[model samples]
Target chain A: MLEKGTTAPDFQLNATPDQKIKLSDFKGKNVILAFYPADWSPVCGDQMALYNEMLKYFSKHDAQMIGISVDSAWCHNAFQQDRKLHFPLLADFEPKGEVSKAYGVYDDEVGESKRALYVIDQEGKIAWSYLSPTAVNPGADGILNALEELEKK
Target chain B: MSTLKPEVSSSDHIEGSDAASITIVEFGDYQCPHCAHAYPIIKEIEQAFGDQIRFVFRHFPLQESHEFAFPAALAAEAAAMQGKFWEMHDALFENQYRLSDDLFEELAETIGLDVEQFQKAILEDAVKQKVEDDFESGVRSGVNGTPSFYVNETKFDGGPDELFEMLKESAE
Candidate 1:
């Protein structure tokens, strides 16, 4: 998986905003990239909700949060509407797990991404990265705290 | 520009009056072995902290690997429709492996749910959507796996005891 201080790889992936988003777009700002397995499970729901609840705090810190999954944009659209999600849920549907593989969160055995979180600094380098086993949720507040610490530096 | 807003449905908003000062949010899969292992520890933490801590569970089913997980999640939600969410939740974890359709019916029976209503609810695509929504939320929140949790919004990277200690300190 992507590691702390490692430069984030650049890629243009499909997003709900009706266009492609590149890593460079958020340059000069902190970015929280959350990789989840699929849409619509219990723990996944709370995870996004927590982030959604903390949106203002992330914004105040000049950070952007983006979620990536293998589900199609159509599925993601339905998910966003159903949950009233405030962030973009990127579609890693085409090219079949390309983005997930780039991030090293892909599970070759199941063809799905592992639950992972990466905190990328403004310089486009990874400040922190975490990969949880197949049955856990990524730590959101830890990412937030880490961001706060990094901001002080 | 990426804007952030409260992304959760109003119903899911957890309400707790605990001044214990610590909250743990878990993302788990019912059929997941690790989750089954973690369930008791979570219960222990809840018992240990009482009102001093808040514990929330989010669903992250690995559908590709665990075909029964999605159905199991729907069953729990169906039970939730009748105010039996916790009972069904426990049943699912307790009977994690036998998640087949027949077993779901048995669980529904065990949980005192109207078998017909439970079966009907399971057949409804919308009920599945509810579980799906939770999974999507997990993905959006950056959950890449199951049985993962956040301690007062900080990710806990250790075992149950490690998490328990962190929760204890955060409560202070």
Candidate 2:
């Protein structure tokens, strides 16, 4: 995975069937890039749902979160609507895992993205990064802590 | 593994012996179906273990996904004002499928709380802050989802049923 202080690689991925979101679009604000394996996991350990609840906290730090997975835009749309998610889940489809690969989070064995988190500062430098075990949900505390640290700079 | 942050304190809703060797802290959402499913299993665990187990519940309501979750947590906190926190907690999960603003009142009356006081308490800013505090603590403690459990201050990597198995084996 990318290390802190590195310039985050920019990419454009599909946020929906017709809408494309670029990493550069969020240049002025802090960005949280979350790469997860898949959606519609069991109800108990839902990583996305946990993040959805923390949107207010994330915004309080002037940060926007984006989720990336190998799933198509249609799949992300269904999952987002079902979970009432307010943020975007970018589809790393078409080329398949291209964005995940750029960040060194793609898993070739499973043909999906690994569970990873990256906090990018306003200047697009990686402020923090974590590669969580596939079975575990890394949660929001790390991201929040990273954002708090950014405020001190 | 993630460990419980801040630790269980006077602010938590607790049950079982104060000096119990095993402590279970659960961060749960009231409107979540998975938590409702774990409710009865938790009851059974408490019954089987008795004094050896200490249980604490903290609200981690996913307000966006579960629309009524925050309100239900508020109702429980309101009931706490009348010394009926567990009663309201159980009632909320037992009747989760029918959770609504009205159901809170009905459950309050059934749990024998003063209806007028209950209504007033739920709207209190302090009560809302209490629930929000619980949520913030949960996030800081690395709670991944509703019904996340911490056993002896360390995160338990599985569901309630798996927790039950571990408890039973420990007692053997």
Candidate 3:
């Protein structure tokens, strides 16, 4: 997985079937990239729902949280609507695990992205990264703490 | 991130003995179906374990997904003012299917609480702050979802069923 102080790899992915979101678009803001195994799974569903509630707190730190999975744009759209998620769940489709691979979090054996979190700073450097166990939901504290640390710099 | 933050104290709504061999803390949303599902399982666990285990419940309301969640938490805190936190907590989960703005008052009345006082308490900033504090504590404690449980100050990886199995094993 990517480490702190490393330049974050950029990518353009589908936030929706008709809308594409680029990593560069959020240059001046901190970006939270949460890569998980799949959509509709129990753990993933809970993790996303929890993040949806933390949007207010995330915004307070000038951060934009985005979820990434190998699911297609259409699948992300359905899941986001069902979960009522405020953040974008980008589809690393077509090329499949292309983006996940660049971040070194792609699970080749399962053909899914592992449960990983990356906090990219406003300068586009990896500020923090965590590779959580596939079944565990690694809550918001880490992200919040990292963001808090970034503010001190 | 896996340890229970601040630890359970007198400020928390608690069940069972402080001297109990095991401690279970749950960060739950009142209106979440999963939490409601865990409610009965938790009751069964409490009944099965009795004084051998202590249980604590903290609010982690996902208000956006469950509109009645924060309100229900506030109602429970309001009931806490009357020393009826457990009563309101049980009533909320038992009637989770019909949770709404009016249900809180009805539940308060059913719990034999002073309905007028309960209503007034829920509107107070203090009650709201208490619920928010619970949520902040949950976040700090690494609660990832509704019904997130901590056993003996460490985050338990599985659901209530798994917790029961672990407890049963230890008791034997």
TM-score of chain B of each: 0.85, 0.98, 0.98
As for candidate 3, its clashing pairs are none
Over the stretch B1-172, how does candidate 2's per-residue lDDT look in tens digits?
6789879999999999998999999999998898999999999999999999999999998887778999999999999999999999999999999988799999999999999999999999999999999999998888998789999999898899999999999899
Per-candidate total of colliding backbone pairs:
28, 0, 0
Higher-TM-score candidate of 2 and 3: 2
Sorting all predicted structures by DockQ, with the top scorer first, yields: 2, 3, 1
DockQ of candidate 1 is 0.09
| Alpha-carbon interface RMSD for all candidates, in angstroms | 9.1, 1.7, 2.2
For candidate 3, write residues B141-166 as lDDT tens digits: 88898789999899998888898998
| Residues A1-153 of candidate 1: C-alpha lDDT, one tens digit per residue | 876788899878888647888889999999998888888876433466546645666887799999888888888889777667788888888897898899899988887777888889999999988787666554454676678888789
Model 1 C-alpha lDDT per residue in residues B1-172, reported as the tens digit of each score: 1111114334452434446576677767788887888888888888877887766666667654566877788888888777787788889998876767678889889879998998888878877877776765554455535666666655556556678777677668
Candidate 1 — which residues are off by over 4 angstroms? A1-153, B1-10, B13-20, B169-172
Candidate 1, residue B66: CA error in Å? Answer: 0.7
Model 2 score (lDDT): 0.93
Name the candidate that leads on DockQ. 2
